[model samples]
Target: MFGIRPSQKVLLLWSTPVDAEELQAMVGELKSVVGAEGKVAVENVEMLADSSHAGSHFDLILAGVLPPFQFENSLNVLGEALRILKPGGSLIVRTTDSATTQSTLKLTGFTSVSQPEDASLTDEQKRDIISPVSEITCLKPNFEVGSSMKLSFAKAPAKPSANTWNINLTDDDVDLEDPDDLLTEEDLIRPDPTTLKVCGTTGKRKACKNCSCGLKEELDAEDEKRVEENKKNFKSSCGNCYLGDAFRCASCPYMGMPAFKPGEKVKLAESTLQDTS
Candidate 1:
């Protein structure tokens, strides 16, 4: 058990239904541990996955029996827990699968990760509870902003490029001719913009007004699923940009981006095509 000082804020997340009497009992226990002068507040919420509480405000976060098999839900809850926990804050999770729970917490950037050797509550007390439980504890690093935590997906390997030239020449053939002789005036001169087969709307040769470039169509069901999942996870977004957390807004600098720093506005006007190239 952490020597939780007086006046330290704590958040309690539980999936099980906790009655007022049970909540009061827990709150009273916390008060006893922290001393009478300490102020203890307990929120027996069903889930702690909301982004509204995405800040380092709580000194400790105590969770009970989160759904381990449902990785997305677990990840979301862990992320929010990490985000809201203050620097040096402790996150204690009670889970049946210690290995999975430990790995998940470590992957979520929880440092000094360990399962406490001792137990706060007795075996009988734990056994009496319906939920399968054991304790794993970790602390948030003091210096981390926690905003840069991103979901990374494996990239599909690139296909080899098509043959660029049709011409074939024998190595034995002798040619001392000037290389400039191969170039026509039209090849060197910049082509007229109107004459080029560029999309009027998108200004690209590949992408037509109807978007027949096959970019959208190229996306497989798995890609679509990943996109949909990302849409749900990164709903906060970088200012107005809806692209995933990997991409930075062009209006903001690398370090000064809206994602890393709060209250930073997306100063540039929203562009349909953020990629100018």
Candidate 2:
């Protein structure tokens, strides 16, 4: 039995009109086991074989008995299932013969490959063999004279967590000094504005601030004077910047930002009027 959990996503792969009802019933049974939080998706094998759900993180992949002819290449279907499955996910494959299925699963990088024992088979499975092709007549590799049909299960190994790291430390590796004390007094000191270069020959300018290159106080008077001049000549364009003529500033509230004609639950912030570039 599949150990399905609550809120887990399960994928059921089945052929159209072939054992669809049985697979659907299986999904419903799984859903009941997981209570109200379970979700099940039924898809055709061919549809999933070429899909690119690299990180779908499906908790379970229940491949209801598929005919070997349905899959042109079995590896493509298995590869797709493995690619979408999250680490530690479970995949159950129902095939005509367990021996071939076990071998294929092991060859495809599936861990803990196993088949149900004779005692584990349900009465219905023991009584009848339901598949597209007759299990007895099918040409299978390494087929024992009297091998029985069964289901196979394999686990995708769990991956290591990103935050987990293993490191060996010694007494010599210990550091008791404060990280702030690493900087010298001269390194902390600010530069004189008189020796700094300013972007004076610009059509659009950024507001200068106290930085390692210069003292902001020297540029404050000049910046204020420029701001006043800019306001007088300002047009209703993108962020009052000349770049509006060539490019649209979608983040600029004055020109391109969308607003509800009648105010909705929230209002646009005043800071959006400032140039984003």
Q: In model 1, which runs have C-alpha deviations exceeding 4 angstroms?
A: 35-38, 65-73, 116-118, 123-132, 146-277
TM-score of 1: 0.44
Candidate 2 lDDT over 88-119, as tens digits, reads 67777655555665666666556766543332
| Alpha-carbon deviation at 157 in model 1, angstroms | 36
List per-candidate RMSD values in Å: 32.4, 24.7
Top candidate (TM-score): 1
Best by lDDT: 1
Candidate 1, 148-247: lDDT as tens digits: 6545785689866686555677867766779899899988998785467555576664454366645435444557678556534443444534333456
Clash numbers, per candidate: 0, 0
The local distance difference test score of each candidate is 0.62, 0.56
TM-score of each candidate structure, all chains considered together: 0.44, 0.40
List the lowest-lDDT window of 10 residues for candidate 1.
Answer: 64-73
Error of 2 at 11 (Å): 1.1
